[model samples]
Target: MADQTRRVHFVLSTHWDREWYMTFQQFRYRLVKLMDRILEGWNTGELQGPMQTDGQAVLLEDYLEVRPERRAEIEQRAREGKLVIGPWYAMPDEFLVSGESLVRNLRLGREVARQFGGTPSCAGFTCDIFGHNSQLPQIYAGFDQAAALIWRGVNTWDKRTLPWEGADGTVMPAFRFGLSGYCTYAHKVRGRPGSPESSDPDWVRRQIDDQLAWDAECTDTDAILFFDGCDHNEWDPLSYRILAERFEEESGGFEVVHTDLDAFVKEMAAQADRIQTRVVGELREPAEHSLMRDNQWLIPGVMSSRVWIKQDNAACEKLLTRHAEPLGALSNYLLNREYPSGLLNVAWRWLLKNHPHDSICGCSIDQVHEDMKFRFSQCRGIGEVITSDTLLRLAANVGEPVEADSTRVLLWNGALTPVDGSVEVTLQIPADWPTFNEFFGFELKPGFRIYDAEGN
Candidate 1:
């Protein structure tokens, strides 16, 4: 109250889910069209952008997949810091995936962002995730990420910003924009920027003043945030341009800035001493703010909506982690065989594509789930092939013992400890056994034959 009218940082962002109601390619094509214009604005200096594009590196891969021609332009935008992306391969459901998978997701995101002369946004932008895990502070801090921008799963009492403490005692700034989510400001504005109602300077001033005053009560810091875009929103250069100009002209004592998550976090952190800090870890927050709930309607019924999809997803995860990756690594280490890293990366990406909160939560449309099934099939197929091939290569080197009409197949347990369990062996006319089929005093079925371990 003693100082100036707080600085309002307008963060423009689009929460682009790679696939939710539609297929990945379908959504990606629209993203390409959106980026084309957003980048064009950057190149022409028409839009002063710090527009955040959903913090997922996978979108860049998606955009480049269809429009390889615009690689240079896109790279330039990234270099210029006009387009902020990554810190995640895909915005994942924290509860669904393994902790290791989350680490890999962030690692790949940082790597991808580095390729285009831009670092991943320093803020962990978990804007739309249903909730967050406690380990996130440690994970984000591992990558040197300084803060988190959260929308969902925020406690109204926390007042949007909290000092998120990890299991390891690592602390990071966490900003929460709740109630109406990240695009609350955009919703408050009447129609498009050029509309008669939206163009009024006095009206715009009142809205800003009211929002700032309301937000001011929520925190001790003089910095307030206004997110300018919504879900799957296209980058409207004209609207942003008009608003940017209007805010500058009639900010009503507040310093208006078009910023990204990183800059905003830094600004907030700079005045960290003045702002209240609540040490937090797991941020499921109150049930009231849960995206899984909307008033009396419990929306997270989708968690159990499609049991079969979840079952298949579990199977695929086990196949990749327990079998495929281990076998591939062993084969590369022991046999000097080329590890199928590319195949594994493709498989992991396919898996991550379905890890979006809506997609993996089974809350999407039938068509989207159908596409997810296809992606799951592709990932599982590749993983199976890698595991089977590695097993075959390793098995080939084992010595076989001969016993009369039967052949002994030696089993090599890949694990370090001695295995004392029953093993299923497929007999295919053992090395020394001359006969194709033999029964162990049991009747042979029409299509099945039983062979004794000992030749008879």
Candidate 2:
């Protein structure tokens, strides 16, 4: 990952967000329509030169949005080291993408990557949460990715003023931008709300000129990421190549290149002792028993969010925690191959991305009824959960407390058992309850309480 002179990097971070595309049946319609469009474009060969590489439509899987057979085809491409529309998970934000759900997403994404030919080392947020967290060194390490870019944190930095991390460990690539300045060009532009079909080459060229002027005028380094429109659906092979073509026709001798975003980090890593690190982590302190404070965003860093987003993310985290067990069961069942592959595929696709039948959200009349039956089959039919719960109950019996003693108290706290656990406790619990879910039925002694923790 050493630096090459005048690096021209190209990266395509693609994603799909459509209302009707989550359900199975509707997805079918989308798939057919898109497939027809691609095939037609292929036949006409309207796609030429770099367009073949850039213009080629990719089905980015924030969720595995396809049928099993199509997934197989993608896998085939992956095995051959071909990069055809990789990444197949919803990428539910990593910090709180539910451990079980994240695990499942990774497992499924891995399968899809294997079938396609290239394991997707790079991940795309499409502008959800902010920052490339330090905790994610392990995440990228897991996916064989050395780094990722934060499209959101373009000019936001502190201290070093280059693309350096703040007090938190949010990494951005600002120095690279400073060196390049605005070698790229464009024109005849009008800025809209957020770049919705307005900026012509003239406008872009003007921006480039301003960038050049800014570059010449400034003595110290000023950082800026050239590519705009990170959150919107502006970045595709079509738009990128169009820009490239413009540069080719207009920029005369300036070189343009394409590279995966990670390439930037890897290249930078070669020169310095370490790529500068910092990002916003804890903006506010977590006061005792205060949920709001625990998740607040105070410090400005790479993933800086207005108050609203942090609150929404916190809420999502709570929801994920509340449903951890069922989530774990779903993951384990799928990983263990507890049922037929197709049935598991149907279930997770429904949960994570789109439906297996037609490729949309919410089942059709036919699918809804069928899905109700299928879910029951996936959950209850396999009996993994039921059997596992039964084992938990039986196993606790052998480890019974050695004759309840005043000195050797079993430390009775909250519910001795949750539905997800083997042990259950009585109706009422003691003073020092260790927070847990209570279920029906239980037996308790006069002084001794039954209520215990979830896995009690």
Candidate 3:
């Protein structure tokens, strides 16, 4: 006999990709409309509280950028926990970017959430990210995140939930989506009666029966999750009404509630001892099982699709993290100079704008990638200027003043090891020194020579 007493938590959320098949601006126009409707619904009591914003705070930033007048309204909704936002600034492809980028993404997201008088959700929500990394649990634990809700790149596991262990043995409770994935309940709200695409009134009852049967085989617990929205989906006030009225009329020994991801995590946590499955390491398998009919493709081709974007992304990451940031810190510590944090923050923001799964994975439209080039250049240009200025200041503070007639060169070793090999350096010569003749095949100009600190 089927379990008569089942508790279903319907999580309402929309996975908003900043840019994908459409340009960011084109999508933003729709986003503006979406936010307007959502806020309106909330105010009128048509839609109940607690809607997840794709687990990313960047959407809030994008929405507020256009609807500046709605800031206080958003803050009120956020403060009341009616709007669930990030533990991530953007949903990025895990394998493509550096580890430092992921850390900063979470840091920036929480910072933004607090700025708006909101408490960021601690669940590591990777609903639509291409894949996940092995150290992700460790990363989440570092941020005090309690659990993870994931969709793609989860192959091997057939159960609905498991203890996902990171590479370093840090374990966190993780919920993996079933065959229908996150949009299992989306059709219910989207296809209302009287609409052109509406289904039979009996469809809702049949769906619940089918989903509950599937959930029975997947887990022993009565608490199950059903995400009620999909990509770029708009807010619908009917979702709450439909579930409440239908479930109340039928009863059927099933209890349905509208809740956030954090509440679901807590529910699952209560049953942790019963969950025996342990999935360790990264989750990047392309599911080939028959049961996973709606399984998402890993789409490994995105890694190499637009090679130039990857190249530009790597160059900018190195410039900001390895060069600019370290040099700035050194100047602050050694020379007693204040760090240029504002400049570095701007550079990081521009770079992170390019880290979204679609943007960085090179799976977005041509116009999207073209716009990414501008953001990359902005981050790189800022990093280069900071590196140059910091180096000049450090050189001036460390060495003795050079003679007026002599030229001096300072070498900076950014690496941790000592430098013992021959190094090549570039010198700036006075414009009057010499000009190479175009007619001459190869001409050597007499330039300044280099010397060690001892004038060897």
Best candidate, lDDT: 3
| lDDT tens readout by residue for model 1, 122-233 | 8788877777788988888888887887755555543767777777788888887745666656655534556776767667656656666666677656677777767777
Regions of model 3 farther than 4 Å from truth: 1-6, 156-158, 187-201, 246-250, 290-292, 416-418, 431-444
Task: Return whichever of 2 and 3 wins on lDDT.
Answer: 3
For model 1, the superposed segments whose C-alpha errors exceed 4 Å read 1-6, 190-202, 236-239, 246-253, 277-279, 289-298, 399-456
lDDT of the structure predicted as candidate 3: 0.80
lDDT over C-alpha atoms for residue 391 of model 3: 86
lDDT of 3 by residue, 128-219 (tens): 87788999999999988878888778764458888898999998988887665666556543555466544444565566567766765676
Which consecutive 10 residues in model 2 have the weakest lDDT in total? 48-57
Q: Provide the lDDT at 38 for model 2.
A: 40
- lDDT against the true structure, per candidate, is 0.73, 0.36, 0.80
Return the TM-score for candidate 1, rounded to 2 decimals.
Answer: 0.84
- Return the TM-score for candidate 3, rounded to 2 decimals: 0.91
Per-residue lDDT of 68-108 in model 2, one digit per residue for the tens? Answer: 44555444434443343323354444443344555556567
TM-score of each: 0.84, 0.48, 0.91
Q: Which predicted model would earn the best TM-score?
A: 3
Pairs in clash, predicted candidate 3:
none
Ranking by lDDT: 3, 1, 2
RMSD vs true structure, all candidates: 4.6, 12.0, 3.2
Minimal lDDT window, size 10, model 1: 289-298
